[model samples]
Target: MLTPTPTIEKPSNLVAFAFLLIAFLTGIASSFQLPTLSLFLTQEIQVSPAMVGYFYAINAIIGIGLSQILAKYSDKMIDRRKVILYCCVLAIGGCLVFAFNRNYYWLILLGTTLLGLGSSANPQSFALAREYADNTGKESVMFSTIMRTQISLAWIVGPPLSFSIALNWGFDWMYSIAGLAFLFCGLIAVTLLPKVPRKKMEQNTPLQAPSNNQKSVIYLFITVFMIFNCNGMYLINMPLYIIHELHLPAELAGTLMGTAAGLEIPIMLLGGYLTQYFSKKALIFTALWAGFLFYLGLLFFQNTWQLVLLQFFNAIFIGIIATLGMLYFQDLMPRQAGAATTLFSNAAKLSWLVAGPIAGWLAQFWHYNTVFYVSFLMIAIAMVCLMKVRTVN
Candidate 1:
């Protein structure tokens, strides 16, 4: 049941589209928090900058643990829809807490725990989509790639809309609406998604010895972790830099994020098209260069138009790695798609576990723009690590 092989007849087209909608809704719901949480911490909750970073670090830590544990047991369950439904419900509750509460203790103990568990929805949705393709005997890799685009699609509008609502009405209104997205997402999962029957449980195989490429894969994971930590720090620091340091209006931050997300879809498609002509290492190096350029722009170009233009580089820098990194792990562990994808997801969260506190301290001690400087240095480290691994396809 845990394997990628088909276990049942193909699901209906309606079921397929339902998975697509779930992916988008889950993303939009999650996206509302991604760009706005730091702002909420500073403006609504009145926390210190370091606490904002620590908040994310703690949340990511819990989220990684919960997502992995849930993913571990999902295939063992009779119906994974139950797991998705439970995660969605937890997300809704977390949003409500944000809507009404300001106590940091309650927010940390209860709020982060709920949202942390809620992080499981994303991987579970992809897992279901992968299962959708596998059981139907459709092409799974392309299917999973397309499924990921639903998230990019969501972010194109989600951040701008979330910030707009927060700016005009208040944080509470923004969060209440976000809760509704999760409500609809959960309803769709329990009502619209399929409950495919599972194969009889197979005996667990003993874990094999480390493969020859395990060392290289370990290096790749380390490099990817470092790279994403920069992104995690950027996400926490960027809005504050724009609003407090630059004295720019709050809405511009959302638009900047929206601009990058708008370009990510097309760039991902184009990169996928070009893979036959370029080695994955070559493209990854190109992305790292684009990342360096992006952070450099953030350092020097503080104006609105120039910053907006920089998102073109941002899209290329982030879009390729997000998709390819997962594929890279899948290639390294072909038999364990479940484990591979979960590891990819955990790498993202695990990065944040470290990134948040560092970003907070940097902003507190030096200046907000210093976070960009450190972000620039992170790309150099990533590029160096990339060179140590042998070339990948």
Candidate 2:
């Protein structure tokens, strides 16, 4: 009996590089909308706070439920590129709706749903990277490196561009620009991505089964959930805390938040390199502990400058946590790339969905400071759990 010769895979550097560029652009466009969209809804559309919260919650709920379905469907489909192309189109349409519509509730709901679909690009991007890596015999660390680089690039470019556009041309132009960006990404997706052939089932293949110890993945998911809850709490409540609790002016609040975002870029860039020397588990635990300390410092923050300084540290810690956590999770499930990415993404969304309302209620009743304390406690707990995690390698 003759042994079957193994099929050799060819390298596609052009394909891999193009996918990374697209991912970077997609992230930049998405981040541009983050700082201003809520304000636009509340101030321009005259939507109530409660309604804004509800809209965000609904977006999270839909995204979390739909992500796995989309991932599984993409796995079954012959062409993953088509799924990505359609998602980009939906994002563009969502942007158009928000840009043009005067019906506040309808527009907000449609736009949020579109944002959810657009956000789907995140996992899909990782899936694409994983496919490329598997085909070319590249290490999984390269995928994490690409993701961190893209995220850092997006953070550096997005805020200033959005702020400038909003300042000169108004929020309408911002939405229009975001829509154009999405359309551009859609076009790139359709033009650049080749059809990837579906994999055939084989006996004793690495991709055939889940790894024996998946509980580590579960712990990583829990840690991601905790970190994201802290993130969501900060995003939802930070401005209010600065304005209402700290009595800072609106311009100052905006400036501080922008500065925090700017600080994240360097930290994230450093994270890509640091993960090489440091244990992923140690990096994550340290980030959580540092974030907890920053949150605790918020209690004693006296002046605007103190809060600003804390935010800088907060950004650094959060940046490290996000990058390392993602790398760790991706390594844990080298086979189920789409499912793993979807699971981690959904865990973050789940954190936000649960954290948002509770943070709002805590602010309403106790105080914003109380919310921070609760967040700090959660991070502390997460750090403990993360310390218990054993590295998969």
Candidate 3:
């Protein structure tokens, strides 16, 4: 039988609303860069696809180290607001640097590393939401759902806007807009955010070496790593595949990605309701099974319309996995919200770090279709690991 823990006090509705708004703005800033990044790297900057992977891998490596350090500090301080503030400032600077220095590969690499470190804001935001809910008697899972939904909504809007900007103003303008947005977000964070009390912020138990919880966290980390390995291959390679393999207009790639993210919004909202009826285990199983089938289709689908249609399935798999993966780790160690969320976020970054170079090498030498096969295998392995960990449901 599970023992119940006491809930912490919740922040005022206004504070919560502010957090959500900040989440949306940051999401927009981050998403706008995604649809056009590979295009800018290869077409405008004239870098090899393999080089794109290496650059991103380096970025993720920097993010892993910086985020780990920041998360630990937030947990100890019991205040994520400061970390979020720092991230926003970094985002603003990095985006501007990336915007102006696109021609120099070394500069671009440095800017991307800073942006990667800044993106740790995503996990910190989730942790803050959890802490707020604990204090307010709100559901942590539901807040997570809402937070993720806001990001999904941003994905829907950001991509189309990014595509239009790239088409009209030039790709540099996309980074410029993102930089301004990040600056605005930083101002909001500094002026409006509240602080958690020392007592409320501290972990329930006294400081000690990690318990058995660390073991399960490790297992879950591997699970998340594999899930995102599949994601890295797709996000980094799909635009290139569509442009090079299918010979489609570059704008369609953004449309396809945006459409999929749009479809994900409802799924994310539905996740809150689903948890009331279906077990987390059941939902995660559904997602992995859907993913397995979707990646399998990637090997066969050649037509643009077919790939577009596949986005619906991809949206479902991605939405569920992203939402549940965070909640699962938080559930694993409820007290260390900062550490848990950061670990889960790092799992994805770490996967990208590894997958980037590997996927690039495969696509460079072998074939684009080969990436899908590897992704499918990764998803299958994640499913096997999920089956073994009965604690999740």
Give the TM-score of each candidate. Answer: 0.83, 0.85, 0.86
lDDT of 3: 0.76
Best by lDDT: 1
Clashes in predicted model 1: 0
lDDT of 2 by residue, 212-248 (tens): 5476777678888888888888877877887887887
lDDT of 1 by residue, 1-393 (tens): 222322343346767688888888888888889778889999988999778867877778788787777766765665677878898899999999989999987988798889888867777777666665666777665566666788999988888788899999998999899888888888888777776545553114222213765666676777788778878888778889999988888889878887888898888777766676886678878888998899888888988999999999989888888877776665565444445667778888798777777877888899987877887777878888878766657
Candidate 3, 79-179: lDDT as tens digits:
56778878887887788787778665655567876787677777777887787677666777777888888888888888778878988998778888998
Determine the C-alpha RMSD for candidate 3 after optimal superposition of all C-alphas.
5.0
Against the reference, the lDDT scores of all candidates come to: 0.77, 0.71, 0.76
Error of 1 at 25 (Å): 0.8
lDDT for position 230 in model 3: 87
Q: Point out where model 3 deviates above 4 Å.
A: 1-12, 39-50, 102-110, 170-172, 198-210, 240-252, 300-305, 390-393
Q: Which RMSD does model 2 reach against the true structure?
A: 4.9
For every candidate, C-alpha RMSD to the true structure in Å: 3.9, 4.9, 5.0
Q: What lDDT does model 1 reach?
A: 0.77
RMSD of 1: 3.9
Each model's backbone clash number: 0, 0, 5
